[model samples]
Target: MPDNVLENVGEEYEFEFVDVQSTPVVINSLGSDSADVGLLAYSSLANAIQNEMIPGGQSVIAPLTYDGPRYADTYNSTSGSSITDINGLDGNTLGVNGVGSAIDIAARVVLTRNDIDLDNVEFREVSFGAMPSTLSEGRVDVGTFIQPFFEMNSDDLQTVFDTTDAFGSFLKIFVTARDDFIDENDDAIRAFLGDLWTGIEWWKDDDNSETRLDIAEEVVELPRDLLEALVQTDRGYYHGEDGLAIDPEWLQKPIDGMAEVGFLDEEIDMSEYVDNSYLPEEANTEPTIE
Candidate 1:
């Protein structure tokens, strides 16, 4: 999305994409002023603030994606495995990219709801790329998958459950910056958000579907047909009528869930951390596309 935004409004502002491995690193970068803006899972915000990872802490400025019934992270086992559902996960190993990551927290919430003791369920930190193989090899009874990984390997996996089953439709990933940086670059941030909303609007239009898939094909390393399937399903991204507006209620679900599962020290009020003021007025208006 940032790349698309740059293409449409490059003359107005400059952006450099830095590849970071995880949300913690993104938070560290923002806290140190090394990065003006970073993408992070909504579940990590409270912990970052509580740990004092950022000097003045971070503020979420825009939502990047949402996860729910149609699209969400999933816990899966090999297609013919004995672990047919969440009930089969008891006293078994679960794989996640990180122990306290958004994926892990979501899984914890689901397990807790099923009356499964977290102490009995082992959480193995398996990278996303390794999850499919890990499950197939019996190294982990279930592994969490996101995006193209899930779509790419669906034929061999059976989903035990989806995160949405626990938290409902919730804000997944979001854009954040240090509170001080937001204060310093108010107008520039607003302009950037406006352009970002423009990019989002362009992408959400059904007319641009082919072009969007063509662009994804270049970067995603997936078959053309698979890419088309993702595009057909809105690529599992949230494109609401409010454009780039961040709904505090959408974010609060995960925040409260994270705390319930002990991923966060306590629930952080999302309204306090979300600053929709940076979004332009047009963002609140309904999208022009159907």
Candidate 2:
């Protein structure tokens, strides 16, 4: 997940989802350029906040520490490795969606953890839609993209490194909406959470394995094999319970690190940036379906 996604709806709730993409016109039809709530890759939303696209978005729960393949996502979600760690990334180029973009920052942040200087790592800004393709062509050393890009094309590409490597679970896929949305349509937001949780619940049920795979392939549009791998028992996606559960330690570490690296302003308080009351009392708290 890219950074912009914010949570904190409630400690009671857990996890995050990638906001389904629709045509720009469809997004515009929401009646306001300001989406009361929008699910985004954690980094995307994080970048949005940095640019003031939305105010006060915080990650509620980080279900899975996010990871991007080192190369194009043609195949191999868990196959090849990227840079094999930051030390390998000491002096190299990173391809990103754009200049000074979230992907660039995420890559830099991961590298910075190894005491790598941003000035030393060259950045190549390409269009978001074209990044994966660009990486596959060997035009760039590394690229940061969410699921479909890496999932669909990891056939030959590799994941050099992720936020989790240097920062310890710093990666996260998240759900976020503008602060106004949280203040205004509490019910709508709640409903959104319910449906989202239901969707994930259905996705993890063993008896419903067929259905789950179907949705992942058709609904979520995930690569068939990768979707299956994610649904396997005791691995991928679901944790003790809430697939969306935010690891407090994981969440805060990145926040603290980002600020330490000058990615965020110290003036911003985490509380004002997020809220967690919206989560229901019993999230998928147990790994067992019981």
Candidate 3:
């Protein structure tokens, strides 16, 4: 957590972190005022806004990460599978984390771009942790993996393609708050964004890479060696720029792609939903390092 590294921020504000794995639950929690701020994939948040799940819609405060060359959501098959490439996936079993999740949408976009008929392929919803084993055991011909899971099991799995091929460097996850919540607690939101930027800057520095992995190990159940491997290969998280600012141009790719694949009811103008006012001044400036 950011508070772990930024003790002074924690001293100023009190925070209670809740682990809600399901995206729908996160949306509902925000709607009911059960959660102040929520983390959501681009698809989930866009769907919630279109459907009016949250009272006054959501205000996207900051972007968490984007799918890019260094790191991205992946499509994988067994090390020695018959399906060697994206074109060969026709009529084969495809596994996704969820049917309508962000990864699922990305898979559809990739398949569509390859001219693979969506109806001809079978999609099985599997957990990320189980995807590797599921492919290894022949339960599914191909599975989708994100982050450490793909890096951890790379030796046993072969990549078919990543989301970058279809969506380019698109927005993946972001931080959001209910419209009413932002209106009600302006100061708190700014403080949180400021603290979050501080944490992001600290995490981006090369000097603190080992410490970042250590913090990751403490929070997640993965081993230190595995975490080290992920960091060493640059397969870890990619928080864009210093202040964690939202880039409308990068976000538009997914918005257009989701509509093209019918994942979203209609394309949305992200400018209306994104609120950069809450972010600190540093968010607008370029990073000192890269």
Best-fitting candidate, scored by TM-score = 3
- Badly placed stretches (over 4 Å) of model 2 are 1-34, 41-85, 99-102, 127-133, 148-155, 220-223, 230-249, 284-290
lDDT of 1 by residue, 1-290 (tens): 55543443465566788788988888878878889899988756767876888897778888776786357889999999899889898989999999888888888898899999999999999999988888888999999999888988999999999888788888788889888887887777887887777877777678988888888888876798988878648556555535666768778888898889876766678888888788878885422221
Error of 1 at 223 (Å): 2.1
Worst 10 residues of 2 by lDDT: 68-77
Per-residue lDDT of candidate 3, residues 1-290 (tens digit): 55366643565556787789887789988988899799888888878878889987788888777777468888988888878889878999999989888888888888898899999999999999888888888899999998788878889888998888878777778888988878887888888888778787777677988888888788887999888876635586567654456667667777777898987777889888888888888775532222
The predictions' CA RMSDs to the true structure, in order, are 2.7, 7.8, 2.3
Local accuracy of candidate 2 as per-residue lDDT tens digits, 116-191: 8888877777765687667667676666665455545556565565544534443344555555556666676665
Positional deviation of residue 53's Cα in model 2 after best superposition, in angstroms: 4.5
Ranking by lDDT: 1, 3, 2
Better of 1 and 2 by lDDT: 1
* lDDT score for residue 91 of model 2: 74
Per-model lDDT: 0.81, 0.50, 0.80
Q: Model 1 — which ten-residue stretch has the worst lDDT? A: 281-290
lDDT of 1 at 199: 75
TM-score of each: 0.92, 0.66, 0.92
